[model samples]
Target: MKITGDHQLIKKINKYLVLDTIRRQFPISRADISARTGLNKATVSALVNELIESSFASETGLGESSGGRKPVMLLFNERAGFAIGVDLGVNYMLAMITDLSGAVVKKKRIDIAELEAGALTDKLKKTIRGLMPHVPASPYGVIGIGIGVPGLVDDQGSVLSAPNLGWTDVPLQSILAEEFGVDVVIDNEANAGALGEKEFGAGRDVSNLLYISVGMGIGAGIILNDTLYRGFSGFSGEVGHMALAQDGPLCGCGNRGCWETFASEKALLVNARAAYDDAADADAAAPNLDTLLSLARQGDPEARRLFADTGRWLGTGIANLVNVFNPELIVIGNRMSLASAWIGEAVYETLDSRSLAFHRSRASVAYSQLGHSSAALGAASMAIQRFFSTMKATWE
Candidate 1:
């Protein structure tokens, strides 16, 4: 028993160190790995061999020689084990299969109406199973599944409430675990997107960054000091529902003039449609926002005006965020940023006019490079973190 325990402990410790080192600095040679991890050369070589055998890592040609023969470089196997990441939103369900490196191997998207948990969970289960074949078959199997939900999620992976989804206290994680037979993680979509950006996108280098997901609603993911800051109850970043106006439009969160009511896609579309209908000009005849943006792209005056107006409103919200968080970068995501060329300019203008001078100069608002995939990619990252943390725990 003692021998087996010691063997397992050492094995886990080696796997933990190897995976950790590779994650931070991949495409590294075995000798470099030894130096960084303080593992002896033979131990590093043995661990590298084990990782390669287990399909968790692979050789990536050779590195520049120091003194000895050109050493083979090692990297985390992006094609090794897979994880499923799902962004379940009010309008769509985006599912992606990713490898240990959080690179999307396959993606699936489905449009679904906002509904109760029972029906939604059923559909989600089918969607997840449908995506499994897309992930490359591997010995480790799909490590687990992570979900970026559109509402408040408790620490226990319960959907405390998803007003958009008409859910309250839904055990989404347990339901998914039961259906998929794997570990499940649930977090707010915006928070997940923030993690995605911080880990793999534009905010990677920033110590403080804010990811604002402007979809059907508004929410933010905040990274402070290079770590995700989930406030007490994991609800710290609920900035979208922050009241921006005392008597603004009625919000889904039972508030008036919430930030999202002014800045979200629904808000932009709503106001744009209103502006289009109210305009006495000839170009205001069209009421649809998508059509308006299309016309704006073609130089329609009314369309341009509508986008600019909405962009100003969005900028107001962003300015408030800037004042509060003082993040180094603010990433705008979701469908609205598609019109970044027009709206982005307007956002900059509003911020320039409204925010404190210091913040305006320090922070740059940019479109999300990950596009709509930020949430799913972030979910995959959660799985990767889980995998590494588990390995570390086993070692400890």
Candidate 2:
């Protein structure tokens, strides 16, 4: 026996297909959409009409014709809606607004030395509230808010644990939704970085890759077969907590010898401060990542060596991942990327020597192209994705 379906489901599916086709290949004609989607011309036309009527698609001038009247070109109205994305770091908050096409319209960064949950939430609310008015009066206004936190985010958007930030069991999504009266999405920052690169940066062409976010801490975003692979518990990308040394520096996760303990921005600063103090420079200002980076840029041997040491540690972890995953590419992102100039050689050197010959040869590592905006833009993309999902012609 065969099953029958209602027209609503079919209509929703078909309309989504048409919209997706146009979104991907804009300046597209309805005739081409009909051919590509295997839907008849009339169905394609009807769907296109729906999208245009809903302000999702708009007609441009005529296109080149094939033995008939010039077909009108259709354009996806990216500016019809706007989305807000936030990248909440251990010490900073990066927020931005983007069109549906993921082009950033505005961005701001605020630094917070401490991560008290109340203060953090208040700041988050304020940042988003400030951004809402700048949304350019689109059809959906500020459609939704997407946040990337450096922690384990469950399906319900509760941040289970972010040790570095001292956060746990925070219902971030619900809190934001209730406060702002809009949809909210929260995910691991590394995962957001991976999505950012896949959608707009270096990893766009690769299906299997890893995004390593080396910031105040470290994490990995695994993309397998063009999909973000959140593990069985949505905690897959906590690569920073991976044990590297049997006895090394204590990590924020209360573990010794974790990869981030050696390779993260926090580690770099710790080492920098210690080294400076050892030199008996009591009058020296606290050395931060930016100071060390500037010193390295100015050819300070000590600063460069510090970065090299960190790079070597980063490479060791990456090599392990390369052997295990054999991904097509590995994108090193986040704060560590800022030191790529100083650390590039050491990372390459370690990977070359340590990683399995086959895996190392197959996989290539590079820094984030979007720099600090990777997670923020990616979060925005998630909000944009949800906006479209909720508007898929679900009619009565």
Candidate 3:
């Protein structure tokens, strides 16, 4: 059909409505899609045919019919394309390749001591290249790459500052895009984590949610009314640097008593190290988080106390979030969530005491459903979203 103007817009909208309905309710029949989307049967059929021809959908056998001929069911072709997602942490990098449906087809994690921008970029390139060999050929093979970084990322995907990695004003997105010859997206790790949870994890059914990433540092991804609330300049959700204590410990962000300085995995480790240093066997090597968790599990009083203290601090920060945002759900993610047993109690206790009664009563705190994979998966999901949006525009 030679569509134009308002008719073309309507056709495009109806096409995507049918596609989305099939994606969500597949294996759904054309009649079902038409009914769900309120589009005419002929329009739904035409869109489905186009999607199938474009490899974005498929006929998935027959479904039960309400009398009359058996209806052919339609399914979204999740394997039509792939996306790469990378989560760059201070001490580690996680990379994954996901299909259009956000299923991780392959993934890898690499630990690194290097923090120089060049070194990190090289490492990322190498990792992505390794995954490329495994990507199956499709209509849009490796549509794009999305990266989640532990730093302040501007709209142009520049890392303005990442104190933990000593990176500043690095054009990470452009660098990767140039290397791979594909679109590249970069955002704060917490924001990616929030998107991950909202689309595929704990916050799947909740519109208003908070994803708190408590790792070497703390950051939050705010979801208000089912959308990521990136402020102007895309530098929102740097809640870790929010000052909580005027005379508290120094933070890497050149701030005193930042929330992360008290509630982060770094704080937990510091407290654990302090406890071990004061022990009778002071010569023992400082314990890592896993070691501390083992000690806490084995009923080490000092280790348990440290986790509880960290949890209390975490709760204080969460209380502030609850009062301010009143999110329906708050997801506590990253490495610290592994020690939920020791930390959860103190978190609840502190939150109960600190948060406003109304807000505290409404907001339920939970651990990340995707655990350590949230950021990486979120990046892949974002890439997939971008790809579909572009595809919809082309149809329009």
Candidate 4:
């Protein structure tokens, strides 16, 4: 994979290389970008000028030179454009607007009482409309919209199935694109969460990582060689549906003994309700997740036991991932991660008992640094990446 001969292609690649160098090392001189990318000074200057004209980069104050005259520093212009990112959960939707650098400019969340596709789409459109007016004037106003759905999505952005939302064969990307007149990118929430963590959270330094989103259900996002590993048909990383028992509890995906049935937030809540029902003094009503977490933090024995059980189950699934993927890091996120203090212990203990010594030793488990915002932030980052790639194409 050497890029040979095509002069235009070479120039395009060099332009992106220089842009990336400047992005990573901001307020840097053209000479430094040339030095870092091994591109000649003249080429670097040309690319820098193009970037400035395109409003992608800006010239800041001059920097002290080692020998001759001071050099003008270049900065990646984050406000050149904006992107919208949405995390569509089963019961709620989180949306955020961000600049090219992924810094969130505005954010909103709406709770959904109905799961119908039409209703959800309506809410989504309304939210986008509200955000649109706030976007500042730029070269590419609202360059794109990226969405993370809790379901199986295809390469073309069709949501194949979102069982929790009762959606099937939903053309979310096309719908949004037609409605808003902007490019829309869609992916599974877990995959988006993985990207979010990789770009801004716990997995930032690692090339091989796994992000497990454990909310109402569980799903995993896999990253290999610092790239998302979407398998054939873009349907990989559905770890929640992996069978763990032959005759266990039924799962929403029409399977029994699925991993999520035993380890997800839904599972934890079910277990908590059962525990409450068993106690003589227990109230008839079930406690919410926050209340349950509070009880556990207060040393409620039953809550502790339930979380421990879920943690062990979570660890069992993670062990399988470790043995198969050999990831350098595993990040646990979504609502369930609030119990990581207990779940983490059980995960480690289970890995120690069940996982291969070599495989388990190489991987470290961590909680998500971005918490609930991971998916939305990741979606925005995806849009930003797409915008830059499109910009590169025009350069050629």
Residue-level lDDT of model 2, residues 1-396, one tens digit each, is 123346677888898989989998999999999988999999999888888988999999999989999999999999998999999999899999999999989999999886978889999999888987788987768888899999999999999999989998999999999999998999999999999999999999999999999999999989999999988877898999999998999898898999999999999999888888877653563678888888888898878999999999999999999999999999999988999999999999999998999888889898999999999988998988888788874442
Enumerate residue pairs that collide in model 4.
Answer: none
RMSD of candidate 1 to the truth, in angstroms, is 2.9
Backbone clash count, each prediction separately: 0, 0, 0, 0
User: How far does residue 29 in candidate 4 sit from its true spot (Å)?
Assistant: 1.4
User: lDDT per prediction?
Assistant: 0.84, 0.91, 0.90, 0.90
TM-score of each: 0.90, 0.97, 0.96, 0.95
TM-score (C-alpha) between model 1 and the true structure: 0.90
Q: Which candidate wins on lDDT?
A: 2
The residue-level lDDT of candidate 3 at 150 comes to: 93
Which regions in candidate 2 have their CA more than 4 angstroms from the true location?
A: 1-5, 280-282
Instruction: Write the residue-wise lDDT of candidate 1 on 1-396 in tens digits.
Output: 999988888878877788778877988988888888888999888877877886778888889998889988888877667889888888889999988878788898988874877888989999998998787878778888999998999988999977767789998888888888887889999999999988888798899999988888888899999999999777877888888799999988888988888777777678666676676763745555467669789998767776787788888988988998888999998777777877878899899999999987999888898988898899989977786676566543
The better-scoring model by lDDT among 1 and 3 is 3
Model 2, residue 164: distance off in Å is: 0.6
lDDT of candidate 2 at residue 151, scale 0 to 100: 94
Task: List where candidate 1 sits over 4 angstroms from the true fold.
Answer: 1-14, 38-43, 276-289
RMSD of each: 2.9, 1.7, 1.7, 2.4
